[model samples]
Target chain A: MAVDEGLKIELGKQGVFVTTIEELYNWGRRSSIWPMQFGLACCAIEMIATTMARYDLARFGAEVFRPSPRQADLMIISGTVTKKMAPQVVRLYNQMAEPRYVIAMGACAISGGPFKQGYNVLKGIDRYIPVDVHIPGCPPRPEALLQAFMTLQKKIDGQPLTGPDRPRFLDAEAQGEFPVPVQGEHDLEPTSNPGVWTVPVVIR
Target chain B: MASSPYFSLAVLFVAALGFGLTPLGLAWLWGRVFSPAKPNAVKNAIYECGLESRGDAWMQFRSAYYLYAIIFLIFDVEAVFLLPFAVAFTGLGAAACVAMLVFVLMLIEGLAWAWAKGVLTWA
Candidate 1:
């Protein structure tokens, strides 16, 4: 009986600890999230800030900034997209493979912000390529960007890719102006479940 | 006139090792005690600064960056060769100076090739 017990323990040492599909998938997803560093203007600074000391984006498992678009799974549009830059932006969007997400990180990207009236600006980025989330603010605070990321997390968890709407963005026809009501701004104030969504905006 | 080289080298090596080790060791110990649990579906989702991760992160990259990296490598190699001359300048005199000049001329040729190929153009 003792010999059998010893054999069992030895077998345990060699056995694969994660045998289930859920566990394996979770492992792959949590590990290596490559982000493309495509900064066009001002909001790019805030994106850099997210990866810096106070924010430390590495903690969230997305600090790897891949210069190549093919390797990245997330693209943060951090500034204005001018007519000159539009074709380049569309080309970039096409280069990325399926199952990717775009974060429009400022009013400029969300709806061209103050530059909406300019003939050079593309208005909202959704006009060119789909936007998964529109983060408001002249430049949304880094914490707000973090909140946007969490909302993305929730969407990934709950939603299914049934058809066209499954992707994290609104359809071009459904696209709207800046500061589309999505959620509250990030607050350092003490709260029960700090990251929970308070206000909900439905974009049809 | 300079102090013994051996002592100075030893002190420099020890200080460099200490600087690299302390933070690495501290982070290791801290992780052992307080590592967060591995994330699941909910926790592992992509962050959007605080918004949802939308669309795709992948994009087309310009080919100019590769050309720039190649140029950087050429200059980097030139710098390596120049270092030896810098160290032995007083002893090597005019012959070494002329050789370095020749080497720099070769490097400039490579730059000219890149320019002719139009790799230097932003577009």
Candidate 2:
């Protein structure tokens, strides 16, 4: 159960911390969101800049970009998700430990950007893996990436530890592995992950 | 038992173990209650780096690399001994000189044997 905000504030003023298990759990999870070190294209440079001194993503406790999916808590899709690279990306996402989050950090990653018409581009990484945040830009500035990160943290903080609305990692029955697409004779065997995404039917 | 000196040592040992184990036990319990493990083929795969791993890690290396091992030992051991011998050369007695000569000759003999075996010739 959530503690009353006013009561919590009063307790804090009196030097006593009042927090529920959910609050403490969410606090810990939101604080240390280590992004995977994998990068695809130009937006990766902006992602790198965000971690550097000027933008200082370290302030949010997300400076540690783990090279392995096993250690990473977040995956920043920082560029165009080409069809050629989509399989590997989905495989990496599948391999990541539970409570994983994805940030589609550019126009390219979110919706293929200028390469949308190109046959080589995957259109969006969310086609294969669920994206937690979508930052709209050809290549989003470091500040935009930081904003998306804070938005993700807020999303994490609001997630209930228990109940039907609890995040996928907390849900035992939720699908764990997103299928990795294979290169077919023409294109990827499967265009999108049906579990996470479905082709939107435009109503005329 | 309270008067025994070993009792305090036993207490400290138990405290030390508790200090290390308490958090571990708590974490395990927390996982069991809250985070249900979600293991699948992709997540449990042997290779972690995106692409599926191709070959066996148990593949054999070329046996011809042993020649380089012998060559390395000859130079490495000679350098190690020769540096100290050279540094203390003027202060050494004739017996020490003879001993050093024998050591150098032994290494030289190994090199000569390697040369006779054509081990130095790069294929």
The number of the candidate with the highest DockQ is: 2
Flag clash pairs in model 2: none
Our tally of clashes for model 2 stands at 0
Name the best candidate (by lDDT). Answer: 2
lDDT of 2 by residue, B1-84 (tens): 989989999999999999999999988998999999989999999899999988899999999898888899899978998999
Model 2, A21-61: lDDT tens digits are 89888899899999999999999999999999999999999
lDDT for A168 (candidate 1): 33
How big is the positional error of residue A83 in model 2, measured in Å on the Cα after superposition? 1.5
| Range of the 10 consecutive residues with the lowest summed lDDT in candidate 1 chain A | A187-196
Candidate 2 to truth, TM: 0.83
Question: Candidate 1: which docking quality band?
Answer: incorrect
